[model samples]
Target: MDLSELRVEIDKVDKQIVELFEKRMDIASQVADYKISTGKKVFDKEREDQKLRAVKELASSEFNKTGVEELFSHLMSMSRKLQYQKLASAGAAGNLPFIQIDSIDKASSRVCYQGAEGSYSEAAMKKYFGEEVNSFHVDTFRDAMAVLEDGSADYAVLPIENSTAGIVSEIYDLLTEYEHYIIGEEIIPIRHCLLGVPGTKLSDIKRVYSHPQSLMQSARFLSEHSHFEQISMKNNAFAARKVAQDKDKSQAAIASALAAKVYGLEILEEGINQADSNSTRFIIVTNRKVFLKDAHKVSICMEIPHEAGSLYHMMSHFIYNNLNMTKIESRPIEDKDWEYRFFIDFEGNLADSAVKNALRGLREEAKMLKILGNY
Candidate 1:
């Protein structure tokens, strides 16, 4: 046959395929109705797997077999999504484990932050809750979480990630360890400075102190002065306080200008960080599982089975539902050799239909899934 004849035949097949798709979807709707009445789940992995194997075997060539598998996978996903939509409409979809609130009360709420008075977490808390909001300080990030768990504070502000240095691993692990829920987040512009007591000069500094992240962020500056000893403290503010109290002309700190001011120290060198636009993202966590009604972002962590295409199949749910995933990070699971947990940040609220469908699929496919937050 000529090329024109082949093209015509392909178009005719496409039309027939469209008609079959519609008919299949109509039958899927009936299945959804039966499932709803019987309180049955939307997804059945074994059944879908059997159907995919059967469809792939129908193809004569290996290439066509792969194509058929892909095609049926998508069709099955669509049918399952339609069933989920129907279940949601019928009020049969399971309830999410979070409570939606109109807003957080920042006016009278007590806030806690890791580090001393002038750390970035403190600045984030101030920016989120305002200056007049009652706040306290803790020596470590765990201490901050402890305050929240013990009902000593309404919210705890802790650094989750930095633009230059990547995620705060300790905080991520703590998120899994603790029951606190992240209700909000704030980003603070970081300006690492070399702070010292008044009349101290950069030439006289022999040792520098700050948080480990601050030290890494200022790695370029610290490398230039290899003669100086670098000491990692619990926080930059605590380092600044140590320098101010010690009255040592040979000791300096890499901390925020706010820390310098709070500790009555001078900025001997400004903008010491490697990147000028460096910033840190901090999360506002609370003991109660509550989220604001207008939250537009969601964070989740999941562990998928160790099988070929498992991760791909899990992510396909988000793509099929048109959910935009913003960030994904993997961390090694403690004591589980060669296994990891993936933390994902996606742009959608729990109240969204597409988000609901995606979460439903993820929960079904992944070995474990946890909704970290909706904010």
Candidate 2:
């Protein structure tokens, strides 16, 4: 359409949109009444899934699916909010207590972080909650999850992704398996600084330790420092601790400058990321869902049928639905050779009606689908 005609058409659409939105709001109020009478909860997974499937089955083309899902996801999210407002007004889930990491006393609220004291995940937790938060150390990701489950810690900090390495499939898979919610995220620059005890010269160092990604970033430096043998550790921070504890000034670690300071080690070298902008994304997970004021991202994991154009056709659902995808990653499905599970992180809250509808359609079309979490 021409610019003038497009403007006029958009105006007309806007008018219709406002009208439909009002109508949706009215129906949402009615839904609140029905739910109250039936003693039903605000979120219904099965009902929500069934609703989306019905929409997809009725959709004829990708374009329609895109537009409708986008429109409906927002609509549904708003509708649910309105319904919640009504329920709250009637005194349901009233005066619930919410914890803010900042407000919580660092000395009181204990936390679990993966790896020993010098780990990147620990750095992330300290960044998010400050050093005052007494941290329980863990050896592995599952151990961190276990701490939260066993009530040993109120929350857990763990790395989700790295800029170079992309998505950490292990974290996403564990998200589904663990009883926790990703309440917040932190991005920490991955500076693989060379660390050792103070007064150690570069020539004195004999060994270096770091994670695979860290080792990869510092490959050039390692190659140049022929005297030092590179040792692979589970993580950068752990390497720092190992190097700090080692009595030999000849041994060092490749970790962030922060880790070196935390572990009482000295930086032998700095700026190790092949790209200076290296960063790792970490998440703050808790035992319960977070009542996020403005949900900035939505995370979903789904599966597509083993048919021609299945992936392409399903992705169109996101496109047609008008959701801006931030990330997409695929993992192999166990016992289902060649079959994969996909994780998609996108803009907009899942509470929106259009997103809900689009997802409903997607679930219907795909062999398997799951909303990993929405935060």
Candidate 3:
């Protein structure tokens, strides 16, 4: 046959395929009704595996076999989603563990942040909870989390990521270790400055101090002055305080202007960070597992089997449900060789139908899954 005739034949086959797809979906709806009446679950992994193998066997060539398997996987996922929607409509969807609240009571809340008074985390806390909030400072991020868990503080502000330095891995691990829920998030613009004690000049400085992340963010500035010895401190504000207390003209720190003001230091240089749009995202975490009713973002962690196509199969749930994944990060599992845990942020609330459907599939397919927060 000619090329036009062959293309026409393909179109005819596609039309037939669409008709069959509609018919199959109708039957799947009836199946959903039967399962709902009998209180049966929506997912049957063994059945799905068997069907996939059966469909592959119907293909003539090796390439066609793989294609057929992929095609059927998507079809089955669609059918499962339809059933999930029906289940949700019938109020049979499983309950979420988080309690929904109208809003966070920041006015009366006691907040905690890591580092000294002039740190970026303190700035984020002030921005999120306002300046009048009863706030205190802790030495480390773990200490801040401990205060929140022990009821010493109603909320804790912790940095999660930076636009230039990437994610704060320690904070992610702390979230897994501590039982805290992220109720809100705030982003603070970073404006790094070179701070030194009074009468200290740029040429008089020999040693510079700052947080490890700050040092990294100010790499260009540090590299330009290779003669200056770099020292990493627990926090930028702590570095500034140390420089002030030492009263050494040779010692300086890379910190914010607030730190300079708090510690009585001069800003020798401003905007030292390489990126002009540097900013850090901080999470507002509380011990209670509650989310605001208007929450529109969800964070989750899951572990998938270390096997071929396992990750792809797991991600298909989000794709099939039309969930827009905002970010994904992977961390190595402790003591588990070659295994990792995945953290995902998606644009949806736990109360959403699409989110419910995606979570249902993830719970069944993933080796382990946890809802980190909804905010």
Candidate 4:
């Protein structure tokens, strides 16, 4: 066929594809109507998962695999929207938990975060609470908690873990030290970038600066260059500012890409984290106890007697109650010389009967036990 004829045919196919999508959406609307009549959810994750798996399996071209998965994921999101809209029109989806409306007021809320602006924790706070937050700065996690304890702040943000680093031990220790609850959680995407003073050249870098966590994340890129001395700062943003103010062109900072942009520092390198999937999980702590949403994580600490099967017995208690323990860590009791304290994060909430039963059993079998927070 001639090029003109072929182009016309391609345009015709594109038009047909658009029409087919509209028809599919119309069918989805009908399904939503039926679901509303029967009291059913607008979104079914299992069905969406199955459809995505089938579509991905049919993606024959290696180069198009990611494109196809992304395309379908977007389509599934749209499907949920169309379904919910239809159900909402019928007064069904409007009553569902997933269909949310209105933003909560944070105008008077004081948000406490480690470091100044451009820090990951600060970014996390804004992401969770937006500009409505009156953000306060803290030099350390302990200081942030102290702010909340003193009623200087309404909320304190702390990074609990990273996909690459596993866990932040200091943050976990602080969680046990303070009386607070994890009211909410956010996962920040971590992208370590090398930042230097505006006029600084790569050749002029004699020293690198960053928080220990940032340095650890960018170890690979920093380790290869032996000429640069790595200096650890208390926070990532503080390091960025130090580099920005430093007269030495050889001085650079390892921090978030956002931080480099904020400080007007040149990015020597980007995506310096150990893994592409690296993310830091932050929890919002509030001194005032709040009833957690049904889907929430509960953290508790308990001490088991120093006996042969005492630890084993605790494990059995969790098993008997059919509770999944997300995390379990033991630290030496600060002043007790050799005794140990256990910190655990479990799947169920304090309101769950099974969780309560397991805790009761643990308390009966052990010496000291505490339900840190329900959230």
Best by lDDT: 3
Sort order, lDDT high to low: 3, 1, 4, 2
lDDT score at residue 155, model 2, on the 0-100 scale: 80
Candidate 4 off by > 4 Å: 1-107
Model 2 C-alpha lDDT per residue in residues 1-375, reported as the tens digit of each score: 899999999999999989988987898899889987786766564776577667766779988876666556556655655565566557553332333232334467789888776677878898988878787788888898888888889888888898887777788888777767776788988777888898999989888888877888888888888888888998788888887777589888888777877889887778866777778999888886543656667677888867545686567656756788888888888889999888888876655655664565566557777665555
Question: Which candidate achieves the best TM-score against the true structure?
Answer: 3
lDDT of 3 by residue, 1-375 (tens): 999999999999999999999999999999999988999887898999899999999999999999999899878878887887888788787888889999888899999999998899999999988989899999999999999978999999999999988999998888888888898999999999999988888899899999998999999999999999999999999999999999999999999998998888999999999999999999999999999999999999889988767788778778878999999999999999989999999999888888987898788778889888999
Screening candidate 1 with a backbone cut-off below 3 angstroms (N, C-alpha, C), the clashing residue pairs are none
* Better model by TM-score: candidate 1 vs candidate 2: 1
Q: Indicate the worst ten consecutive residues by lDDT in candidate 2.
A: 95-104
lDDT of 2 at 299: 76
Runs of candidate 3 with Cα error greater than 4 angstroms are: none
lDDT of each: 0.90, 0.75, 0.91, 0.75
Q: Specify the poorest-scoring 10-residue window by lDDT in model 3.
A: 307-316
lDDT, candidate 1, 1-375, per-residue tens? 999999999999999999999999999999999999998887888998899999999999999999999889879877887887788778776778889899998999999998898888888999999999899998888898899999999999999999988999988888888888888999999999999999998899999998888898899999999999999997899999999999999999999998988899999999999898899999999999888889999999999988666787788878878999999999999999999999999999888878887887788778999888998
